[model samples]
Target: MWLLLALVLLLVILALEMLRFVRNMRTIPGPLPLPLLGNAHLFLGLTPAEACLRMGELAEKHGDTFGLFLGPSYSVMLFNPRDVERVLSSTQLLTKSEEYSFLGRWLNEGLLVSNGRKWHRRRKIITPAFHFRILEQYVEIFDRQSLRLVEELKLRRSRGHAGVNLGEAIHLCTLDAICETAMGVSLNAQTNVDSEYVQAVKTISMVLHKRMFNILYRFDLTYMLTPLARAEKKALNVLHQFTEKIIVQRREELIRSGKEQEASTKEDVDDVGAKRKMAFLDILLQSTIDERPLNNLDIREEVDTFMFEGHDTTSSALMFFFYNIATHPEAQQKCFEEVMSVVGQDKSTPVTYELLNKLHYVDLCVKETLRMYPSVPLLGRKVLEDCEINGKLIPAGTNIGISPLYLGRREELFSEPNSFKPERFDVVTTAEKLNPYAYIPFSAGPRNCIGQKFAMLEIKAIVANVLRHYAVDFVGDTSKPPVLIAELILRTKDPLMFKLRERVY
Candidate 1:
């Protein structure tokens, strides 16, 4: 009789938990979720790329805002710009979603994932690194690397451009550029494609993306039992070790040069009107928060964060830029003409920071491409306090997803939203008429991307250099678009193919 009573009590407890879960979900409209598993089964047997597309489809059917469950966690996805603005613009809602905690093993408390006072302090310390004068100095690096990329492509052109994986080649170029600017170390990732550091970065991202969609891997013990988890551990060791080595080396170099003291005092700049030789890592080494200096582990987190953000995001945007230019011949020719006008007929002439500003058409094209294919398809924020969206109550602890991918393509926000018309970004007429929150490729608000200016300069520099010499054409089936996957950053499911032809001036 006592045993029977215990079983009844256990069943009653579970029944109450179920009732509470159902009550919490009843306020929000979404696809019906199954017991225990929730909506996780939607991703079964689907690749990340396919899953991304399916998510977008669900958003389309469910309207602007809807709730879903990833395991037991109740979350809402916001597709409307107004809803997104409300969540992103709030100072109190600064905490990132639980999904980002998955990256803590790699990124720790870096700016990308940190919250509250820590994030505020780090943001202040790192802001100076991307200053105009410093980015002006980076232009020389961008121009030189772009020239190297041109040379590499010329070599690959010998094999014909029919099946050339331009995306992979561009990724290498961006990786090399970021390593130099961010770490002050040359990995030469473009030329040395077999570098362990480069390979490890690639592997870690793949492992993390797979883990994200697989609900079973959410628990540490369950994940550890999987082969992918072992692979992730190996890749992480390689990545963490690489960053730690660079941080130590950079600190030692700064002390030897006696610039460590100067870097700590003020913005590091030379008397000759040129920026100092300091990189992002150097700034982090010299930075402190509330009288506390960052330890080696803290430094490593920021360095790894910058390296991942700087390279992967820019490369994804560039790949889409190349695709857009290839498909639209008229826009490509206009862009080429504009680049030639500013850069002149000499293909060997280096693109300067000033010259980059004058390529108006090229800038428009880059903006248009970004709008069409944002590198980060969605931004996840965990609600810190109870919030109301369009008269609906969203309780605290709910994960809210803001999708630039869906918002950018909304017909209400953009006229002819699916069309790749660069003219829409024209500064004078149409651009001023649009809403700021509606077109957030780099996002908006105080937490908007600090590296946006640097990204723009890099994109313009590389695209201009390529268009100065080569005219790109789509070699694949033009009817079919490349399958897009949203990991931490957006990516193509397959290689982005383009035919490059040398232009005779």
Candidate 2:
């Protein structure tokens, strides 16, 4: 009798969920979904690049706002800037989507995925780590790493290599810079390109990407039985062990130098001594919540977050920036001229923060690149409470998908959206006015990227350094552009090749 009663209760709950799903289907416009599977079949067996194109087709068919169901989970793709504003700008709707849970084993409660009070507390603690004073110091690391990359590229040009892959080169350059700045140690990723830590990061990221899109791998019970699970475990072990080891080493160095105690006593990072620079890990080590210092696990999560976020995103931005300027010779020349005028022709003179600030034309080119190929092609958020977004009532538990890729290409938002025009972002050009939410490469509002300044500074430094040394030209056919793979970061399926000619000013 008890078993029968329990079965009846379960049926009733399932019935109610179906009713809610029906209500959503009636309210929103999208491709008709089959029962049980919904739109999951549309995405199944598709590569990330193919899947990205498929999403574009769906948006074109369903208008700005549409609903899709992957299994039992319902997601509303917000293509309209107003709807995106309604979701991203809301403080109450800050919870990440279920899709982000794929990163749980690796990132844990890191700032990127953490929500509610935990996110709030962590954000507050980590914000100061990117303050202008600290960022000013990071410029040294950026200049050094970028110079190393420039030398490597120059070496390749000398060896009769007509083309260099900017994608691979920038990834290593950014990795080296992030390691030194975030952990106060050099993995020398640019030098030791085959390091165990670098390989583990790549391995784990690939496994996570595979799991995120595969409906069959969503659940832990089923996923654990798969071969990818073994790869995930091994990669995660290497990642966690490396992060923990670095955290221990950094903390010990801080203690021995007496900077850890000094940082703890200080109310602000600016108050910390100017003689010694603090890594992001050092700041987390000194930080406390509810009067208790954060342990090794706490420090590791934030550091690993920095390591992942800092390098990958910046590398994507740089790759696109290189491709954009390489294709647009006029824009590339303008950037080269600006860099020469601002930083001078001396390639040996490192790009300083002050010099980087003065390259206004280069800044415009960087902005355009971000608009065209945002590092994070898509952003996801989950609705915790039933909320009215852009005058429509979206039910709670619905996933929100905001694609910067689609938004950037909307003809209504940007004039000549398909063309690469750096002047589109120039303040004096009024061809099209931009909504703050419309062109969010670094995102917008309260939960916007805290390290945006750091990213911009690094990008400009690298671009200026490269342009100052070499004239870059695209190596691919204009008619056949590289296919974009919308993974953790936006990347092309093929390497973005560039030919560099040494410029003698």
Candidate 3:
């Protein structure tokens, strides 16, 4: 009798759940979902970008948009370029999701993570910091870093190593650039190369990225009992301490010097990327939202957030650019020809903004590279209010995953899309399927990356400097499709190795 009663009770619970599931299933188009789990399990083991791509494939398989339940957290995956444009650009439909509790803790309320009125205001304030004229003023900063990198390569050339870790070199250069430009102090990361601050920054970012997808982490209650949560908090502490020291010291130094303007010489970048009339921190320090100055904590979070954002994305981009150039001889040769022809033979002669812009092929190459391996693989925007997408009734409190990673690889979007062919991006062919949102490497929206100008300039400078010194040669099968681990950005599980041969032209 007891056994029978237990079975009956279980059946009753199952039946009630089934009824609720059926009722909830009325609105969206998706595969038959298992009780409790939903379609979210389909993303297991995949990077968020790859998971997003899988969702697109499923959408094409099933048609248009689909419903996924991340355990109980419901989200609608938007794959159509038109739909993506609406959600990403429109303030009406969606807002930045606060998935990472720790990120909110670490980044505070900076532009990348902030939303609504605050995001709008902060984005406007930070906009002036990245203007074209201001970037042109930042040219020497790019120059100094490139020079330091070349000088380092020369050291390796003299020592006769198979190849220096270009990824490591680029990392240091961008770190120094970010520190000086954003934090207002030169870490001299390019020369020191192994500073604890540098190591801590990378660790914190990697940890932070790891934390993004972790579901159990979302519950505030579970975090208190979890070992991973404790370690994450500890890691955050290290990163906070690192950036705080830089911020406090730099602010003091600036106040003492009494120089608070961008009216200085290129000599400002003592380490590299110098001559900025402003430390990026100073601008943000003086930044006001509705005329209220940012507090110390607010300022620290913004600066720490920007430092990681400014450095990692740009450096990883350059690393992939080298990997692609090394693998594709014809493409690399074309890029080399363009760089050589326009601004050639001398590393000391700075690459100007006009000349960098003129290197359309290089631009296309970076675009192509990013499409294949996007720096930020996935973006999540949660619905601020109840909305309709593709005429489907999407409820409030739903997360929407908008991924360029999937959009770039669609067979319908580009002919032979999986192939690494920068040539496809040439003017005539590109105009045929001209949805501007289809190829959103930096993303397409009002909330697009603020430092896009600075990133590109630095990348172009590095490529020009690199090609001028050495002709890249792959040590092994650089053609093999790399396994990219997409966390905050898509990065390789292994080093993209090569044998560097000095070009004596």
lDDT of 1: 0.82
**Model 2 global lDDT (CA atoms, 0 to 1):** 0.85
Error of 3 at 213 (Å): 2.6
How do the predictions measure up, each by TM-score? Answer: 0.93, 0.94, 0.85
Q: Can you write out model 1's per-residue Cα lDDT over 1-505, one digit (the tens) per residue?
A: 8657755664464454445446666677777766655676777788888888888888888888888877546789988877888877888788989888888888989999999998998898888778777788888888989888988888888875365677888899999899888888888988889999889988988777766667767755457778988888888899898889988888888789886666564434333115466577877787777756688998999888888788989999999999998988999989988988898998888898899999898888898888889998888888878888778788877888888887888888888888898889997756546777888889888789989999999999999988887889878878877778877788888778877888897
Clashing pairs in 2: none
lDDT of 2 by residue, 1-505 (tens): 8657755664465455555666887778888766556677899889889999999999899889888877547788999998888878888988999889888888899998999899999998888888777888899899999999988887767764758887788899999999899888888887787999889888887887777777788756558889999998999999899889988887787789776665774375567625567788878888888867899998888888888889999999999998988888888888888888898877788888898889888888889999989999989999888888877778999888899988998999998897898888888864667888999998887789989999999999999888888889899887666799988789998888888888887
User: Predictions ranked by TM-score, top down?
Assistant: 2, 1, 3
For candidate 2, the TM-score is 0.94
Query: Model 3, range 278-379, lDDT digits (tens) per residue?
Result: 667766655666656666777787787788688888888888888888888998899989998889776557888788888889988987888777777777
Judging by lDDT against the true structure, name the best candidate. Answer: 2
Candidate 3's TM-score reads 0.85
Highest TM-score against the true fold, candidate:
2
